[model samples]
Target: MSARHAASPGRRDEGRAQPAGGGDGEYTTYYGRPVVKAPPWEVDIPAYMFAGGLAAGSSLLAAGGDLTGRPALRRAGRLTAAGALGFSMVALIHDLGRPERFLNMLRTMKLTSPMSVGTWILSLYGGPAGLAAASEVARWAGLRRGPFRLLAALDRPAGVAAGLTAPPVAAYTAVLLADTATPSWHESYRELPFVFCGSAAAAAGGAAMILAPADQAGPARRLAVGGAVAEVAAEQRMERSMGLTAEPLHHGKAGKLMTAAKYLTAGGAALSLLAGRSRVAAVTAGAALLAGSACTRLGIFEAGIASAEDPKYTVVPQRERLRRGQPVRYEG
Candidate 1:
């Protein structure tokens, strides 16, 4: 009897579990396939994408707030940055196999690991951004006297630091995914940065619209439109570049989500263009853009996970490398 038959509850007379390639050759679940080894990439990558977008958006919001003389946006931007920094730290630590060694990340600064670079960026940016945001809070609380005045003095410099790091925060997550073993991520690197940039801008615009009065949100509406155009263009370029491999973006749940996001983003952008002229339009478009940004992030995450789940993506590329007599490096 086969091992499988022997282990079966009532099949004593059946045969041993035949090897996979036996006459009944078919792929079977590995070792009865308990669902333990779910893809690690999905969890970490999504968190990274969200956190990065939040950071970039917060930075832009702070800068925009300063330019437009909107204290509420400045405060919102700071708080958002602080929250994103905290969440990112949690996600990174959680994703580590040895969560205790999370502190080891600070031991050496390596340029090669995008994770390391990201860690530094978060660490460097978080402090000043938080401080700047806190200053706004202090002023509101009537605590901007004595030593608190030093914090107020530092606010401008901190805001500048946050703004400068914003674009890099948006772009670095793409590098993080690109450096991984996933075929879709690696292939889409060029466009991923632009995609992230758009998402960040949309997020910032949404926050501005929600927090600031309509007149003060005019610049944010413009930013959202610009971001949407860039995102659409980059996605198109990425789809074209991948040719057949880009099927994931056009089929399945990933495809559906991305399509919805595209429509929402385009609609939102169009509305935002005219939103500046009307408070109602601005609010509606801002809400839509926010929803669109969330969908895009979710779609990107799901597509990457799907790409990793299939053996074809992993095996075919390795086979090609072997056929070419090149060393095959396995990525997980």
Candidate 2:
């Protein structure tokens, strides 16, 4: 959304009731205004999304490691989960413009609202992840006496609780994005959750792989490979099924970011397959996967904003659907 994002005022140039938002020479709009206004989000929203997913995945990894007696993996996963969740909260609060706005959201529990559900999801996931991470810190600081002993003893339970809520934490943002009026994002309702989950898993695994011992990083490597595969597949299917709405994802700055995400994810997954013996390979693969996840989130966020700013994406797709005798409902 660079040059194309700017919509200068212009009069209707077509004789038809609605201008040809398609590839015709004529076009129409409310003085070149977008059919649907873009979501008033900035870089913070994408950062929030990426960090939330990473936290969820890391919490799950922590639970797995704790259950399986992998101390290094568990500690690393818990620490990363806690750190990522803190970052996610910061981004969310910054986007909301006031910390109290986020606090006010906790007052209501609207089942049908993604914003409500996502807020509750974050709140619920945070407690357990924080406790688990805190327990690890307590152990490291030799605070296993008095009340600190109780905290350290509850590590497994806290980790398991975090894991229980991880899937929703990883996926709710996709639901929230798709529920919006943005043409590209709304059309991608079906596959976005899978993409988000996959990205989260890859990021968490990659980070843990880089931090944990090579011997205990087997699960992280596997998770990274599996996640990269799922992400690539879901994204491909989503694009293929989106018809006209997929245009934004394949053109301009959004397209370039997505291309980079694809290469990084693929390369990371490939390297992870052979990383079991070499710590250096594991670290490199982990870095690629982390970068890929960031790119994927950023690309999708930019694409949605771009599509929302373009009347062509909004009008042409609905018109095409109507021409095909399909039901088309205006969301706004």
Candidate 3:
């Protein structure tokens, strides 16, 4: 046989593949080829994630305010939700690079496509949220004479309808990311949904606190605290589950962002509880919460990128699977 076709006596497979033993055993690669492809998503993707989550969480808060006789909180929550949804849509279209191509997403539905489902959710969510927010503005500006009054009467019902979709909106982005081949993201699928939900709640509540009167901001503060707790708890669980695979989350640009997010989110939650007496403190807390939420999404995105770019992450895991006689291909 020619040198190129020569095989080593130690190999057993057709190509005489080198054995990649499991449990701390050394592994090999085919040249320097990357086993998994990195996502092409840019900053706009994470920005859309944050904005969509905020919109969803705020819509739920607005519904709660409507039922609780908190007009200031209701108005603030609904307006924020509607405005965030608008901005999110713009960012998504901008990222797609063509408005017409973006519209093509609505042309067909695929049960297997998370993006398709998310697009439909956004389309359905926008109408009720926008109408509710507009009705709030008309009522606040003393336009309760004509159609404004008619619109205002639909506020509660519309807010309720929007609220019904909020939880999924705040959570589906996690599924979208986790469904990918990115190692860190896929591995954390168990906890990412809850983490996003908690972050969303905190962002919505913090924004409401900043805009609503102190007397009406009680629920917002409480939500912030509860969300912070859940976020921290879920993140901890996720990291623990990752084991050595989570190294990307603690040793690079992603690490720095995650650390900052943790501190800012925790500090903001603390300040929110004590912000009842000082407007400045409330604003500070709100700003921190918003920043922290942004950091969390960016950090997760960066970690996924880091994991995908590194070939070792892909090879080692699959080698381990092979040694254990597990299927090398992903089913879903």
User: Of the candidates shown, which would achieve the greatest TM-score relative to the real structure?
Assistant: 2
> TM-score-based ranking, best first?
2, 3, 1
The TM-scores, one per candidate, come to 0.80, 0.93, 0.89
TM-score of 2: 0.93
Model 2: CA > 4 A from native: 1-23, 324-326
Task: Select the stronger candidate by TM-score from 1 and 2.
Answer: 2
lDDT of 2 by residue, 68-161 (tens): 8899999999999999999999999999999999999999999999999999999999999999999999999989889998997887899999
Task: Score residue 309 of candidate 3 by CA lDDT.
Answer: 68
32-121, model 3: which lDDT tens digit per residue? 334467888899999999999999989988999989998888888999999899888888888899988767989998889899988888
Best by lDDT: 2
Q: Which residues of candidate 3, in runs, are more than 4 Å off?
A: 1-31, 330-332
Between the candidate structures 2 and 3, which one is better when assessed by TM-score?
A: 2
Task: Between candidates 1 and 2, name the one with more favorable lDDT.
Answer: 2
lDDT of each: 0.71, 0.88, 0.83
